[model samples]
Target: MALLKEASNLKLITFAAIQERTENFSYGELDASNKPPPIQVKHLNNDRITGSAAQKFCLFRLFPIIFSDMVEHLKSFKIYLILREMLDIILALPQRKSWLPYLETLSINFQCMMLELLPDKATPKVHYATEYTKIIEENGPPLRYWCMRYEGAHLYFKKIAMQSYNFKNIPKTLAQRQQLRQCFLMSKCRFLKSYQEASGNKIIYMHEIDSKVKVLLNHRYGSQFIQSQTLLQCSQLIHNHVIYKQHAVYVYDLEHVEEIPVFFQIIHILKLNQEWIFVVDLLNTDGFSTKLWSYRVSSYDRLDIVSPNNIKYYHKGLDLYKVDHFHVVNLTSRLTKTN
Candidate 1:
């Protein structure tokens, strides 16, 4: 019984969703019986910063509020802008086609004229990057503004946890740890897939078609035929779309799957135009295979590894790509490009 109490005391479980709905529930669960000290869990809802109390305490973190209000309310507060690649933003939204239209309105009306339009007409263009940069510049160096890709949140959070809490809990059980790792990795992939489907990208990524074909080819003609088929299909897609001429192609592989050389060939063909193509493979059993693949393909120019359990710190960027367990490769240069 004493050993059971100690084990239960050491065991900690955290659920971010429940906390988001109501922190009271988290507190209630913690105070229920005092059998084991409850895990310290924080939901870190992105919306909380936009609420009224945040405006009083941490006004700079509020979203959808005016820059003037932010400047006026908090004279010297640290501001951070979490940005995602335009393609991933589209893929992550509920209505992908509506993204451009919504951005156009926000850029022209909210960000440009209403927010930054000075008495003179010398203001910079209202593109997303320009406006965001202007705000930071005018406001002074953000306490610590980081331009982060959504896929890289996992690594960022891991760093944050280690720095903040000195957490050194790396799972020991290979199979159990692998499952937990997959949960972390697949969470992002699943989010992006769902976002893409919801946003109306009938064809999520150009390579998805080829990837599907590769699966079929393996079953029908055996694995020996994969190389030729991958190359042929890649060439076909490149020729079909003018965009492929300018953009680089990336081929990602799972870490445990031993087909690095074949994927490298595919990456070579896709990056033939001197465009940036990234090939990522998760070598660890931590369930990052799907997410690493999605991170490789998602429109974000960079890849991040994040644990799903620590998703709150990365919600702004992470939540932007809520798709299913699938690969994503964003081909667009900006987050607001339409069609």
Candidate 2:
């Protein structure tokens, strides 16, 4: 876990994702997708490659839940840097098509470094490293994707079978029922109207500000944050989200006992008496939720947003190493103009 938060590790992960082998190679005339080809690699390297970084990372730490929690503890400058590198490396491995040669080079270096750092331990080789390269050159899809789908289907079948008492012809019956159901579903009209559409709520009339910026109403949680009288005509209307400009609103940590400013991006906004109520996505900078480590999370069911007077202006720059398990954009160092 400690190594997971290291700055070096995160940086390595970054290099694996973006950096080319010589840092001078050009990938001209990319396809319509504008992305490189996919890469394939095996999960194991056999008994000889024991206790290797590649093995541990690819096999053990690849799980999203575990990796996300590990990313939260990276706070100190030294640790943050190491963690950034580690994340980059981990992310790069599965993206074999983008940087196969570079990944191979880095994996070799990682294996060597791990062996030297822990001299007494026998380092496991990257299982099927050469084989992975050959498979990728021959244009193979990632084995992990197919394996996961198969495993999921197997589990589903097992669970469904366990629930039924009739084991005599379960397999045959299940297959027939599934096929019939699938065919029935497939025969349905592709343009079938949903309940919402049939109910005439298909198009929601959104209030737009200045003909360009569409106004969003406050959710139940966001409405409770501000005083009732401070709100204007749209106070009672509840919405899922709102978008607002940074100048019109500021993010405050209502959940924290000490109540301080939290950096967040305002994705939506609502108009009040005179101020703007914001719908914000929390920034993953100071605190992150980890099961292993208790941290302050928003009391609101969704992310909490505030409209405070204290709008601290700071330079924003891109921090590519920042990871958001919730899939929200973290605050960048790049500066944006505000009133």
Candidate 3:
């Protein structure tokens, strides 16, 4: 019965057999035409599959086939794998819980393979500028294959059609098309946000380390230790500890809860000393609320923060092979200064 129904559907569509003399669709033929081809709107009156289900089916089947075809066609071609931040990509996925895990797993696998093929050094540097320039630099191929953030997709497509094929102008009017294009760009943003939120939550467990740091400092150095000490003895103790000695140290003063001053101090300290500092918020929950106020300290100047939220960002940036030292200090107690 299923096979019969499928055959009946195939029979309904009109099929045309092409002779050997038929002209294949080519860029030259498309360009030589005086006017743009008519955009056909297929009006389906029947209540067939829902748009969402059809989209899922098409994505699952047709998308894979398209990628396979692309790979086959480009076997001799140099492909550029343009990637956004992982958090951004994750946030951009559809919000349905049922599909998220699978999407995440697939994205991770794809990213790993892409990175291996084109190592970081081989890929062009990412910058916010003309999308075409970035794409051209990243790949050896013509500019047509470069992909970018959805915000630049329309401009990219427009440029490709005009420059690559010498098309005068696309028939579609900007006013008539802007709404649909914007909708796609916005949808991409939403998808990215969803994945970023999920990824951010996954790293929330680091808050445990913050809590432990607070407790350890309070117990050993006394409650008023941070206020009295010019330099945190606990930090030296951390340096002495096997696990934390190599990690760059940053101390946050809970007393000054404002954003600019704190950030200025952090930036100044880093710039003057040329050392990356691992930031620690001195205040409890209240200080964590502001996005701009928190500090990030690291050993390397080029260290990138993985988390979108500022509070959870901390240093795990140490060479594990080096010998480490640990010590404990009381911030309230006066001690002789030593180099």
Residue-level lDDT tens digits of model 3 in 226-253 = 4432221122111211122223222222
Q: Least lDDT summed over 10 consecutive residues: which range in candidate 2?
A: 195-204
Report the C-alpha lDDT of model 1 over 1-339, residue by residue, as the tens digit: 111122223442124422332222221111222222211232122222222321222222112121211222321111112222222332331223434544343344433332442323233543454443344434432323433333244554555555555335543333354577679988767544412111111222336544543454346446454444233212212221111211223222223233121111122123212222322222222222211222322333222222112211111111112224333231211222112
What is the number of residue pairs that collide in model 1?
Answer: 25
**Cα lDDT tens digits for candidate 2, 109-128:** 54455445433433244333
Count of steric clashes across candidates, in order: 25, 41, 17
lDDT of 1: 0.28
Q: What TM-score does candidate 3 reach?
A: 0.17
Candidate 3, superposed: residue stretches over 4 Å from native: 1-177, 185-260, 264-339
Please give the lDDT score for candidate 3: 0.27
Model 1, residue 262: distance off in Å is 49
Error of 2 at 74 (Å): 11
Best by TM-score: 2
Off by over 4 Å in 2: 1-98, 113-125, 140-145, 189-339
On a 0 to 1 TM-score scale, where does candidate 2 land against the true structure? 0.35
- Predicted model with the maximum lDDT: 2
